[model samples]
Target: MHEIPVPPAEATAAVPRLQRLYEHRHPALSPVLAWGTDQSGVWVAVEPNEGTPLGSILSRGPLTPPAAAAIGAAVLSGVAALHEAGIALGGFGATAVRVTTNGDIRLAGHPAAAVRAAPSQSDLRADVRSCGMAVCAAFGVDPAGAPAPPNISPGLVVTMRSMASGAMGPSADRAQAALREMAAALLSPDREMAAQSELATRAGGRELPPITPFLPEGTVAPKPTAPTPAPYIAPTPRQETPVRSPVSYDAPDRPLQTYPSMPAITFPPTPVPAPAPPPPAPAAPATPAPSVPTWSDAPPRPSAPVEPEARATNPPAPPTWTPMEAPLPAPAEPSKAAEPEAPKPAPTFETAAPASPFATFPPAAPPPAEAPAPSAPPAQQTWTPVEAPVWKPGETVPAEPLGTGVAVVETPPKAPTPAPIPRAPIAAPARRPSVARPPSRRGPLSERPPWLLPAAVAVAIVILLGIFGVIVLANRGGGQVTGGVHTTPTARASTSPAASSPSPSATTKGPLAVPNFGPTSADPISKVQICTTASPCNIPGGSPENGTACDLSSCKIEVAIYFSSVQKSAQVSYTIKFFDRCTGQTTDLPGPSASTPASGYIVSIPTDHWTVSIPNGVKSGAIVAVASKPAVARSEPLLLGADSCA
Candidate 1:
């Protein structure tokens, strides 16, 4: 075991207090480790790993709205729990709460015993005030040094400033109200004014006035007093006795006189002698001799007579002075005193000074109290045997070889075994045969039946006759038939005498006259002009002279002729003939010609009072229009014109 050196006494003394603080539980509060103590007389510590101190997180700054509300709710709930536990945080502020990184907010610090043991309404109010201060601080308000509560409303700004001042009074009330507002602002889902009407009543403080015109009230004053003097006194002998005595001296003149009469003389004694005789007769002879008494003079004494009248008037001077010297009486014989004996025993116990008020004594042992009996251990064994092999004393166990090997072992039998069983078989089936029958019949055959014979005889006769007729017809007039049948010579002669007679002659017309031939005239027509004149012409006089003219003389003779019109009905048949002058060859156009009536043809005449324009790029060739007439001949062709028909 290692020994740790002991800490200094002061450091050691703090450990138990810190431990007690750690163990102490606040309702709804997690136990925190007291890391250290701070100069402000506060316990500095971190919240539990799972818990957060609300104050520390809020002190960093105002939280986001929802976060702030959540934290506020948690703080209020924690406060309520503390209140339920009869605990009140004596000092509540942002510094007194902390937030864990996990976002749990918790109240920190140990509450006062008064709060923890049995909290009062006032104690709770105080806690409210502290909480209010914390909330105000969160809003960046410095609660301390705020204006007097009467001047400032219980609002966030006022409370924060008030808390900054670190005093608890009207400012604390303001802070409390601010806390109520903070609770509403942050925690209340529906922001609302706090339930402060009951708070003033419960707190029993002066009711705060409204924020308008001030109200005043009457009050009374107190009384006053006067002054007095002190008295004086002289010193007294009895009063001076406690002080030490001063030294004194005796007179040396006339040897010390003794007087026993003085009461218990405190000082040494003094002595003196009796008076001398009177001078005689110095009064009677005064006139003559005046004598002064010498130091050794022996003057006689005169006796004075006594008169009865003088006696009443004046008394005579009487008798001589005696010079008796009494030796100083021997000091009144010194009184005898008893000798001192052995001293008495001193006291064993000394009286002590009065006991001091602050002194402490060892505490007395308290009387023994009854203690609970310890419970007995349960009978059921719960101890599990360790799996490790136990080494037995005096047993030499051989070490197993360090390699893998399969171990097989055989042991004695305990019980026995049995046998088996069997089963059964199966089956099969059978068969049969068929039958037959005959074919069907027909109807009765026919005999000569009715007209059969006659028909046959007739057929024979007809055949014979047909053969005879064929032979007769074959022999007749070159196989000709007279009337309906073939005839023999005699039959034919009988059937027609006319066939054998000769026919009469008839009249005949002469051969049909040939139509007259007429001479044709050809006329030149300008290329740009219509042909209007020709001998015996068939052209109309008003027609435009655009094409050449070929005229056959008109005789007005009719002839049977066939005419082939180039156009039949509405369709036109056209043919073009090409003469390639360079080749000196004339050829029919490969494509067919188109034909229309002469009246329908629009011939372009260059001059006839108005010019008829020919189409551009018409090949410089002659064009002919022909019509066929069928009356004169089987096929006749009519000519419209000819163009350089060389």
Candidate 2:
């Protein structure tokens, strides 16, 4: 056999153990020889003969009768051997049997032992059923392949089929019966017993080895032959009898009998035949043609009596009966036959009255006139006369003339113009006494009086002024003043009180000392700022002549005030001005006293040492020192008296 590749690690490990077990159990059979794990866990065994499996042979179609019977007998024998060894060939199928070239057959890869070891009974029976299937498949028949022999009941065949189909219950009896039936059929008289015997001999020693496991017990070989003969023959036309008035036939001597019910035969009476001398018996009773078994001319005789010898010699004939043909009636025309009449339409009613009831009412009178006549205009007007006029006290009216039979009423004529009512001119109507209005009770004014705001402002100003005056008075004596003060009076007062106190003040005095200032050095000073808030007299380089009152405090130096020396090509002059804090004015003490034209200042003092003081009254603000570099100093003023400093 060609070598199959070694399987994966797990399969490789399991193969040796399985091989050992298989070899141990099936010593008579060829060793597994070699095996390889397939994708499924099942091992593929390589045997010496390189033959196709029985399944493949059968799959090609029905086998020749000889080969089929031979293979079936061999398979049954193999299964019977396995059953004897208590090994169930689980998963058995035609595929499990292999046919060698020599025509010998062997069962391969029996699974019965494994199935028996399974925990479930269902699984065990499943294995047996599978073996039964293999037998059925090998025989090219169903699990119920043929009607079982008489000794094997039909119920047993049904049970076997059910088992093969995975129905409930153990099928040991069923499978045994089925196997026996197959074996019997194959070995029956009609079969070639010689061929089967030869095949069996060829396959005898080749049966599956006695493995460790097996199917369930009660594995019996099929009976040598059915214990009883079939009572009835298969029905056929030739076996039927001619009709002779309904009658029954009985086999008195046989163990079983069947009688067919026959219909009366009514033959048209034959013309009476003339009597003739008896004829000698014929050599053999003429056999009737299968189609025309009964003839009218045949002489009627009494039923034939059975002879003991004939009964013992011949097999019983199967009963049959002629089928009667009934004639069909003719069809009738549907149109000639009476049909149910169509239902009549329901009746409708009409009223005797006119169709429309409202047609007779008289037409409505023409719509009433919408507007009244215009003749009586006043009447048409909706307004009515006022009932009475208001009267004046003394005015008189003229009377109407005595009516001409018409009663006329007259108003009195104005009293003769009373001579210009000379009396003191009628005082103009006493001015209606001016009605006195009670003083208005409206609430206080809604908006604040304008004067009130000014008053409040004045009061606030006064309060602020008082506070300011007190602050000034208190600060005059240096009572912890905050924020720089510019007035000289305040400064002097603050200083004088501290100086004159009986106890020497702890305050430091003299040329004011600047703290936290040092010359720049290689280590790089972090920052250079002088604290001059406490002292106003000290300037880094300012001469005392500049003025003791010069207000030199809190000054910063301009390191490069004159840049000309650094720039050798030009002559320039720079002036720095200092202002007095107490005077609110500025004075240039030393710088640019006059424009001395030069390229630069060359002196030992580091230019960074030059300091400009901030004056006392100059808003107590910071002093800004600047460095100026010019191309040249002006030889003459471009505009006379135009301060170059400005």
Best by lDDT: 2
Q: How many residue pairs clash in each candidate?
A: 49, 22
Off by over 4 Å in 1: 1-28, 31-47, 50-62, 65-73, 111-126, 144-185, 188-646
- Cα lDDT of model 2 by residue, 1-646, tens digit: 3333433654555554445445554422334554555764444455556345766655544333344545545554554444433344454665667766465666665532322221122333565566556544644456755654343335534544555665522223334545456455444443444334333433434322233122113222222333577698876667668776543574345543455668998989889889998656333224321121111112223255633321111222222322221121123345634554333233233234332333244334444456876653332211111111121222211122111112122335767665554566567767778889987576677546679988999999999999999888886765553334221222123444446322213352221111111122211111112222222222222221111122334444322222212222233234443323323233443332212112212211122234454444333322322223232121110011111121
TM per candidate: 0.19, 0.22
Give lDDT per model, in order.
0.34, 0.38
Q: Residue 608, candidate 1: how far off, in angstroms?
A: 99
Displacement of the residue 174 alpha carbon in candidate 2, Å: 7.6
Predicted candidate 1 versus true structure: per-residue lDDT over 328-386, tens digit per residue: 11112223223332232332333444433422553334445569899665443211111
What is the lDDT for 477 in model 2?
Answer: 69
